[model samples]
Target chain A: MRAQSEAHAPSRMVSETDELCQKIRRRKPSIYSELLRENILEVLKCSFPRFGTALAPGKLDEIASHFLSRHGAKRPQFHHIATEIVEFAHRGHELSKPLICLLEYEWILLSTEIDSARIQAPQLSGNTNWDTSKISLNPTAEIVATPFDITLVDIPVELDGTEQNYVYAVYRTVKHTVVTRSLSYVDYCLIDLIRREGEVAFNALVSAPPVQLTTDAIRQWVIEQSQNGLVICGTEC
Target chain B: MKENALGIGLRSELLEALCIQPAREDIDFLEIAPENWMGIGGRKRDQLDILADKYPLIAHGLSLSIADTVPLNVGFIRDVCSFLNDYGISIYSDHLSMCRDSSGYLYDLLPVPRRKENIEYLTGRICQVQDIVGRQLVLENISYYHRYEDQMPEAEFLAAIAEQSGCGLLLDINNVYVNSRNHLEDAVAMVRCLPSNAIVYYHVAGHLELEDGSLLDTHGTKVGEEVVRLGHEVWGWHGPRPLLLERDNQVPSLDELIREVGDVQKSIAAGDRYACSI
Candidate 1:
């Protein structure tokens, strides 16, 4: 009896592994082939696994394709896919889902730093300290981890030199993280100011200085950040 | 359906565009997303405030989730009412689909079962929305696939919703075409069943076809011939409500979209007037 039970344990373990592998396989072509869909699913799975399961493969693919085609990803580059996914996810899939799904997805993806380098890089500035008391990440920012370095995965051979690879990855990482982090910080600051001083101007959030930055830089940063998720222009903020 | 007059979707992108080209005597009613300006403050609110004074504003919303089984988001409904009260937006509208679930939001407009229960449930929600907004809310037909087995025929379901809710219809010609091609339904028959008196507006847009022969409502391309024909047919019955072009992705130059809008206007005038005389 003891021998039979022990033998059954290995089979059960193998079956579990098989199920997980099948799940990943079924998901990869539809969800992970594009970086944005992958990231959105990753964040969703982490935050609300049950709800995430409800995301139809067809819907995710449609959204992924819509995003890919929108960003001018003519040939489906990983970076383009990732960028589009992040933007769509950040926008909270407005045309398709509830506002909260987006909020929850953004919260999960931005809060977790999959790449240790993203969390530790000193050259990239802004508040690195994950203040539990405050929301440190932007609602649109996402941290993704995959088997392939998404930045290096889809480039042409000539464009895939070591120096280029390193530079591209670094730039992509900084660009996504910085925009997300800065936007989050700005939103947080805006919320805080709204509480402290009622009826705060949108411009005030853009103009306010962080402990280590200038107001002009902050404004420019906010505008740059706005290009992705929020649109900012001429409004007195 | 008289299409030549330019009607701009009250998108945030167009706020600056509107300021640069404020409501001219020729420009038609400005279509505003009710959700965008409802209870929201700051620049968008201020811009809407200014535009409302000049242009005849129509409220469009994405978050109504009229087809959801869950109870209507009363707070959102109240906020929309308050916005309409302030702005005097009579022609309020939303998509004919659900976008929310128990888990908060899926963020994408989703397909709903076409069964009697769904139609009845949605009609109740629409009634509540109409009561709160203090006007008959126009429900736009959505483009979708993956039909449920229990669904009644599409035309019957829509007719039921309109009849029960007493809400007006915003018949999207492009959506009808997309659905017809995808699900192999008769687009004209679908239009025939819709309560003619309740249809107060028409929507026209472009679509992209997938490899599997499925159509997507990308709204990025120009209006196809079939949709244009259907739009003319709709105008024949309903005269013309404020027909608006919605272009979200693959956005062409304003000139191109404007030209398309012009074509719709021409078609509406030519077909409808000729039909009435006949």
Candidate 2:
């Protein structure tokens, strides 16, 4: 029994202390819980202004509390927490679609702007067969398909899901500026296909159902995106 | 960095003003959280590069969790080392409290039990962190809400950790003041017991006095006169360590922060003269 107690000591301490932490957080009038809740709400407000106004008083606190209790052990960096809040909010379907879309757009911009991953430079592979070359989106880049063009709206109040057909490719440039560009439907379809599949051969991209554009047009677009650092070709084949 | 050097935390909100005027006469050094800057690029990275190039940067980390029960995060320590090396920062400090548990990071500086076993547990962990960091890990005393039963004095607990692990202390005056007010302890007595040589620097900030009369260490306001006075007393005891003003939220313009820096500098000068007289 002594040996068993000794063996369980470390685990026992962790459980006891962690449980205490949970209790302290849940206890009424807990300043610790208030601090955590306030911090999460502040970050979200800065990132998602419209959504901040959309939520009622203490609503964000409840949501943030739920998020913290569920994922308490996960390290809470500002960007990571923001990402989790976006996902959590989406899963709950509490906010309107437009608000969610705006949150997603802002999150992408914020995350990409600060992303430190060094993506490989888009280089033209010297392969002979161009149709078989691999294509990929820049790791720092993101693509969004919104029903309406919410990007132009300064304040998003209307929740009406208008289908204005907006597809955007938000990416940071080599100069370190984050810029968004509108993509043609064909280009969006092609990029979406590439996103769904990790990296695709040029031949596969051309044969994909979205490639209603001429083969030459698709080839031109791929080369243009590669040169712009949006995608990389595995080989020039 | 000279003794009694006045510094300010390099918050992102004040980045633009700082960049335009990087060489403020009153400012001595800049403190940054390595966790925030690590693996980040673009405008923020560029801004960091510009500021780091101009100032002597010190790393005051928020996520090291040196007092936790889990195994040390060697990868994060290595990453911090890499960043420090990249930018030529020497002093790396974190709170001497647990911010994480086995389940995950709690994202708050939770109080560690002030018992002998915890001291022993934390001493070993601090040593491991120091070994990995390749320098002495300076720990700050955090202000916490809850108190444990059969616990040693907070100052004694911290001193024990430092003595056992051979680590340094970042004596945050505002935290001392806040904890003393909240816990009904003698703030000056606690500061007096800390080993003088172990204190590497000082952190002074403003805190909020809640309706309950308990103080919260919120770095969102101007540095209070009482905290500044305590800082002066600390300088008198330790003979003027670097005093860093931390303004993490509601950060004002650079001019305003620099003015605060100048205020601390004036107090330090006064303390210096007072020391010379004695």
Top of the candidates by lDDT: 2
TM-score of chain A of each: 0.25, 0.67
TM-scores, each model vs. reference: 0.56, 0.82
- Candidate topping DockQ: 2
Poorest lDDT segment (10 consecutive residues) of candidate 1 chain B: B269-278
Count steric clashes of candidate 2.
5
Expressed as tens digits, the lDDT of each residue in B1-278 for candidate 2 is: 88868799988788888898848778889999887888788888889989887889999998888767777777888988888889998899999887776656766788777777666667777777777778889999998887766788988988888888899999999999998888888988989889999999999888888898988888988877777677777877777788899998788888888887677657654753211110
Where does model 1 sit among the CAPRI classes?
incorrect
Tens-place lDDT per residue, model 1, B17-49, is 666665565457678776445543334455677
- Per-model CA lDDT versus the true structure: 0.55, 0.77
